[model samples]
Each structure stands twice: as structure tokens, then as C-alpha cells.
Target: MRTNQSSQEEVEKTLQSITGIERASPNPFFLTRVEARLAARRSAPGVTTPWAFRPVWVAASLGLALMLNVSAVMYAREALTQDDQEQETVSLSAEWGFDATVMDW
Candidate 1:
């Protein structure tokens, strides 16, 4: 029982010694430097150039993409239409065994 009591007291003393907290502090001028850096960033130009990020440039790029897509679709549709017409002419010629060039002969 005496040994247990001594051990308990030792544990309590160890706990008490570890319970004291130290205040934390930043280095001097840390906040001032942080603020200065933030101000410099705010005043500095962005990482990307102004022309690349501008709304006008974005709109123009989108417009160009849209125009390209529209033109491609129109061209594809026209090509498909021409293909269908050619196929129809070929089928009609095959069924009738008549060629327009035969009239020229």
C-alpha cells in the first residue's frame, strides 16, 4: 500500500508538471510582411495577361467556336444531301437500265 501511494503521488506530480501551457507568439514584423505581400499581390497584374482573361476575348473565342461548329454542321449536312441524291440517281439508273449519257450516243 505504501508503494502504491508513492507511485500515485509520482503520477500526480508528473501530470501537474505537464499541465502548464506556454503562450505562442509570431516573429516580429510577421504580420506586417504578410500584409505587405497581400497588398503587393492586390496591386500586381494577374498571372494571366489582361487580354486572355478579358470578357471580350472570352466572348469572341466562344463566338468563333460556335461559328466553326455551325459551319461544320452545315458542310456535313450538304455533303450528306449530295450523297443521298447521288445514291438515288444511281438506283434509278440501275432499275431502268437507262443512262443519261446514252441519249448523247
Candidate 2:
């Protein structure tokens, strides 16, 4: 009984300590300044590079690099295969004991 009464008193004290403000002030001329800045930025023309203003240049550059890498890999693989084929090998047939016949056909 005593604990419940003490808790209720504490809750009432906490509720009384909270404050709520109903009125707020607004920023004057905020919209006007935002519109003026937007207009000024739009009127400026020489602020950026031609390629930097587009997304296609980056994609094209990536595509070109990918093609070059693919081409280099293909060429390297072809050269390796050609070199491996160029190293010719020979085979021989065994007769009975220690005689072998070299067959080049």
C-alpha cells in the first residue's frame, strides 16, 4: 500500500515536470531566396564540362576497356595454343626384345 502511494506521487511529479510549447516561428523570405538561387544557377551555362555532364561517356569507357581486355585474353590464348602445336613430337613402335621401329607417317 505504501509503495503504491509513493509510485503514484513520483508519477504525478514526473508528469508535472514535462512542458509543451504550442507556438513556433517561421523562416522569413526562405522561399524567395531559394527561388533566386535556383534562377541564378539555371542562368549560368559555362559551369560544367560537356562529357562530365553526361552518363553515357562513363558507360562507353567501361565498354571499351572490357572489349580491349577480352581481345588481349583471346590473343594470348591463341598464341599459347599455336606455340604448343608448333612443338612437334615423334612416336616409335617396339618389336620383340630391344629393337624399335621409328614410324613417321
Candidate 3:
């Protein structure tokens, strides 16, 4: 019974050794690295745009389209004389075997 009581006291002392431990501290640069990562993610680009959809590109495209339309209208208006147009229509009709006055609709 004497030896058992001594062993019990030794076990109690060993268990009480854990109460003297201090609070744990993290690494000094760990929080700084985590904050820097969060800041980088916030500043990074989430959506990217193409260059063709920009205002200057759209304006240039529209101007080019207008220029083509104006040129085509001018060419069609000025290139054909009345006599030449009639002759061309006659020639085209003869080539295609279509009569100006036909029986069937």
C-alpha cells in the first residue's frame, strides 16, 4: 500500500506539469503573407475585354462602311448613260432568251 501511494503521487505530479505551459504564438510573417495574398486577389483582373469592341474601333468601322456605301451610290448613279443602259438591257435579254412582251405572266 505504501508503494502504491508513492506511484499515485508521481502520476499526479506528471499530469500537473501541463498547467505551466504558456499560450502558443504564430509565426511573425504568416498573417502578413495571408493579407498580401488577399489584397492581390482583390486587385487582380476578373474580366478582360477585346480591342475590337472599343469606341474608336466601332467609329472607324462605321466610317468605312459609310464610305463604301457612298462610293457605290456614286458609281451606280454616274457610270451608266441612258442609251448604254437600254443597250445593256437589250443585250442581256437577248442572251438570256427573255422577251420584253410575253404571252404568259
Candidate 4:
């Protein structure tokens, strides 16, 4: 209850502190100057590089990268499968008390 009263007093003080506030005034030509600068920027010609920014080239490069990524993933999967098969064959040979080197394909 005491804290609430103190907070209310602080709020009253804060409200009284801004009693003499005044509105801001703008310069007369500020808007026209800003508009002129905007117009100049809009009318200026922009620079562009020749080779690397074309849509066709970008798409073609992206497609090539995707294809290479897919091929690499497939190759990795095939190699992993081959390794698993070889491991499985070794484990089977060991379990059956057979020589792994003599297993016929």
C-alpha cells in the first residue's frame, strides 16, 4: 500500500513536469529540398555489371550445381551400400567359421 502511494505521487510529478511543452516548427523549404534530392536520385542512371547478373546465367549455374550435388549424393550412397555389403559378408563368414578370402561371389 505504501509503495502504491509513492508510485501514484511519482506519476503525478511526471505529469506536472511536461506542463510547459511547446510544439515543434519545421523550416519553410525543408520539404522542397527533400523533394528535389529525391527527384535527382530518381533521374540518375544506375550502373550494372555485364556478365554475372543475367537471369538465364544465374538459373543455368544453379541448375548445374544442383545436378552435380545430386550426382555426388548418389555416388556416396552407392559407395556406402557397397561398404555395408562387404561388412555383412565378412560378418557372415566369421559367424560360419569360413575364410572371408575364399568366399565365392
* Model 3, CA-based lDDT: 0.86
Q: All candidates' lDDT scores?
A: 0.90, 0.75, 0.86, 0.91
* Reference-based lDDT, residue 54, model 4: 84
Give lDDT: candidate 3, residue 3: 100
Clash number for each model: 0, 0, 0, 0
Q: What lDDT tens digits, residue by residue, belong to model 1 across residues 1-105?
A: 999999999999999988896778999999999999999988886666777779999999999999999999999999999999988988888898978346655
Task: Write the residue-wise lDDT of candidate 2 on 39-76 in tens digits.
Answer: 98999977777984478888888889999999999999
Which scores better on TM-score, 1 or 4?
A: 1
Sort the candidates on TM-score, descending order.
1, 4, 2, 3
* 57-84 per-residue lDDT for model 4 (tens digits): 9999999999999999999999999999
Please identify which of the two predictions, 1 or 4, would achieve the higher lDDT against the true structure: 4
lDDT of 4 at 30: 92
Ten-residue region with minimum lDDT total, candidate 3: 96-105
Which of the numbered candidates is closest to the native, going by highest lDDT? 4
User: What residue pairs clash in candidate 2, if any at all?
Assistant: none
